[model samples]
Target: MRITEVEIHEFDYEVARTGTVGGNWVYDPDSTLEPPGFVLTIRTADGTEGHYRGFAFTPPMIAQVTMVAEEHLLGRDPLERRGIWQDCWRALRHTDHFGLGAIDVALWDLAGRHYGESVSGLLGGYRDTLPTYASTMFVDDSGGLDGPDAFADYAETCLDRGYDGFKFHGHPDVRPDVDIAICEALAERVGDEMALMIDSSSLYRTYADALRVGRALDDLEFFWYEDPMHDGGVSERTTKQLATTLDTPMLGLEHVRTGPYGTVDSLAGESTDLVRASAHMDGGITGALKTADAAEAFGTDVELLLGGPAHMHLMSALRNSSFFEHGLLNPESTWILNQGFEGEPESIDDDGRMAVPDGAGLGVEIDWAFVERRRTGHTLID
Candidate 1:
């Protein structure tokens, strides 16, 4: 079967539990948000179609699908994704190729459906369940995850609920003093029973602040320190220095848009102790798989950022990866990840582990009725 058409649907969705907090998604009741959601469909001439529900971005991905890839994908073999991925990768060069994942993932879905296997199985997966960590939103003042005591109390609550690890986004403004205090308090409370981490989100104003917090984390024995520098993790000199200075492993490159190619720099520079890959941010599952393989070759661990079924499928086959980010959660609120389908925390059981979907492809069914009711824009390319 040959490629015939591609379609993109933009829709509206809102949730009380999940909203932007200092660049990280969090469960917050004080914030009411209507973030746009996207879904892409690619159909062959014979009527088989594959789908991808987008997370993390809306417009660039939409533009990449509707504008850049409109005429480029017609009449090609739908299952031969490598060359198609390369074409879009070059086409989107000016914009970091942000929306290639939408195309690449849909093709993977098509392949899985054709082969009668899950996406993980297509990648030769072995494990069925993934251990989880409660990744938190940025520090807040509106009565949730606000201060040291609030964070400590929440960490203990997660531990009681069977979580294996906990991670929190520091203040969006990057307060080293306040961040250190929360780390110390959490260490006193449940650091030994559960692994701990802090994501600075690249908000630190000065290298000194990152150093101070990194020194504190070294003492607390946190699992990892993520994106601590204000330089946006592009400064190889600073990242390498920080990695050597701190005993806590540094997880960097969340902002890097070069796919797996640039990751080779971080590995050679010895800047990052752990690698960051995302199906959304990193080209697609195909690119993320390359990233994971590159990390494994260097004997480093790779972590998938955010939570979603695409990420779950990729991580299931990775031997060097750890933890499904079951996050941006608020214990007192509903965890609405996306509007069209079920996300993590809901799939996570009492044991704090999530099983890979045994069905073919991404193993997700979209709520088309919900999409129709909230439809915003639709594009068709044939």
Candidate 2:
């Protein structure tokens, strides 16, 4: 069936138990925020529709989505994802392809529904449950991810709760010393028990700082060091030097949003040990799979970055992926973007593996009531 119409439903959601500190989402236990949320939906003439809400949404992205959907999506074949992706890429050539993923994801969800299959199944999935890492929030002074002991204590709790891997997001603004302390603590506390990693979030303003933290991670035998420098993860030269010098594997390119094409430049430079892709930023599942194929051809692993229900499906179909990135999670709350889903966004079993949603399409139900109840505004293309 042909695609008939596209829509963006915007709503307002409260961010509970989360707030920013030091330019990072910190443990503000009493924090509550009302932020606008957007969901992209694509419909076919057959009354089949697919929905998406998992990406890191912003106003500029919403603008781009509007442009791409209006310019390329209406009246196209929903199943002709590759063509749409390419055309949208050309459309967003001036931007970072920000809106392509949301559109493509909705289209994939639509296709999966039309065919009576899950997105993972649509992607030729082999695994049903994927292992996960407890990706922590940036170091906060608010006692949530505050210090070495606090971090170590949290690691112990996460391990007890069945996470087999842990990733640290140190000071949003970068404090190498503090970060080193916490990484070392987690290593000593439970590194032998679970894989450990650190994502500096491109906050290390100086090469020396990134080097220092990388060295500490090496000593701890950590699993990976992610986006260590303030280069927005695009500089091949800087990353090549760090990857060569560090014993710890480097994971980079999350901030680089050129879809699968960016993976080629980074891989060719041998700039990172692990590549990063997301259905959110990488032109949706189509782009992410292209990235995974590119990384596989180069004999490297592609780690799916950030939160989404779409991620489980993507990861399940991936053989070269490491772990399902569960959270920038704290003790008190889960993902704010999971508001209108059937269950929470990421469902972890007792074995620390995330379950692929078992139904058709993206395999998750949307709480349309919630969307309609808190409706803010919408854009529709017919």
TM per candidate comes to 0.96, 0.97
Candidate 2, residues 87-169, lDDT tens digits: the string is: 99898999888888888899889888888999888888999888888988778777577889988998999899899899888
Model 1 per-residue lDDT tens digits across residues 1-382: 8888888888977766555755565556667777788889989988888888875678888877776565668898888899888888888888887788888989999888888899999998888889989987788766778889999999999999888999988876667898999999999999999999998988897888899999999999999999998888999899999999999999999988888898988998899999898888788999999999999999999999887778888888999998889777776655546568754323677787877887888888777888888899998888
Q: Evaluate all candidate structures by whole-model CA lDDT and list the values in order.
A: 0.84, 0.85
Candidate 1's TM-score reads: 0.96
Which residue window of length 10 is worst by lDDT in model 2?
53-62
lDDT, residue 174, model 2: 69
Q: Please give the clash total of every predicted structure, in order.
A: 0, 1
Q: What is the lDDT of residue 69 in candidate 2?
A: 72
Please give the RMSD to the true structure for each candidate, in Å: 1.7, 1.4
Alpha-carbon deviation at 241 in model 1, angstroms: 0.7
